[model samples]
Target chain A: DAGITQSPRYKITETGRQVTLMCHQTWSHSYMFWYRQDLGHGLRLIYYSAAADITDKGEVPDGYVVSRSKTENFPLTLESATRSQTSVYFCASSPGTGAGPQHFGDGTRLSIL
Target chain B: QQQVKQSPQSLIVQKGGISIINCAYENTAFDYFPWYQQFPGKGPALLIAIRPDVSEKKEGRFTISFNKSAKQFSLHIMDSQPGDSATYFCAARTNDMRFGAGTRLTVKP
Candidate 1:
């Protein structure tokens, strides 16, 4: 497809297990973002990459790590997933021109028991 | 802390009625404000947006009203329909983006 896509639409892992969510976009956007959507919290940014190898922390970056080795791929990893981390994760991309609209993938629903 | 605050955690409106959602922010540095709509099991998609310089921007049945001095903005969906039922989020952008808690709207037929 020509849009953003996330892998393993649904995932389940143990509290101490490590899990990774993959995000790939064909648009080659300059900005890629990872967010977690939970009830009553809307969407909170976990991490974002301005460009390949250039990443920054967002509102809730603890316990979550991200790397953008390629402009088209930005992956998020949880070193030790916790039950509190169970939420729907979304990946988005933007052209990075001031205030450009972001294109989002369907999202990955992760559960940690 | 949530930089953007949204009101009316949930809303219900009859078909053809108007649906309104409000959001407030304290950061004057945020120059762009955008609203996103999400259906069940799907990521949010940009619905409409407006800049602080503009008071109002309308596209189809969706409208965004911005009040720069009050640090507030709103989304108004006219003639709401069942298809319009979804979760809507309002966000403010600076170097990073901050999103409101979100509003779930349900339209009754």
Candidate 2:
């Protein structure tokens, strides 16, 4: 409730379907990020937001879309889910874009079949 | 291409022993290096961090040894305990952050 929280701790969906993963932070951090973790690959950033209405792509943002309408909410949407997109997604927030420590959410385990 | 590379995908150690995890980075612009610890079913939390200007930083029983020339850094846990068993991640940061593959450490009780 006080820190960042992600919705749908577990999710199962089919290919070519649209799915959205939600992230909310109570700290109102200026920066928020989304990452997908896979075996051996670690955590690859998908998208990041510097502030409300501003978002940018990260290393693995190809199939993912993110929007931050409000400072407290950043949701990641899979336009067309694919099997390769199945992974544990984590949301993080930081006060600024500097080298500050980021706070991470518990993460959402998404499975695409 | 991976910007950060980590080793010993997994490790096992006895209680009271030392646990070491190494990481290497190719980027010189990285100004910050941080280590994160993650428990099962939980998100990763920052354990220790160091700036490039500092070669070594110690906190409690954990230490970070950094080599600026070699662009390498390591995390050492002294007096390992079963409670320390978890996945540890090393990360480097510039304008954005890049994380290492991660190492799963298991300290036997």
What i-RMS does every model get? Answer: 1.2, 1.1
Instruction: Give a tens-digit lDDT track for model 2, residues A57-95.
Output: 988899899999899999999999999999999999999
Docking class of 1: medium
- Cα displacement (angstroms), candidate 1, residue A36, comes to 0.6
Cα TM-score per model = 0.97, 0.98
Q: Write the per-residue lDDT of candidate 1 for residues A1-113, one digit (tens) a residue.
A: 69999998999999999999999999989999999998888898899999999999988999999998899999999999999999999999999837644899999999999
Model 1 chain B, poorest ten-residue lDDT window?
B91-100
Candidate No. with top TM-score:
2
C-alpha lDDT of all candidate models, in order: 0.93, 0.93
Task: Give the candidate number with the greatest DockQ.
Answer: 1
lDDT of 2 by residue, B1-109 (tens): 7899998899999999999999999989999999999999888898999999999999999999999999999999999999999999999998788999999999998
Which regions in candidate 2 have their CA more than 4 angstroms from the true location? none
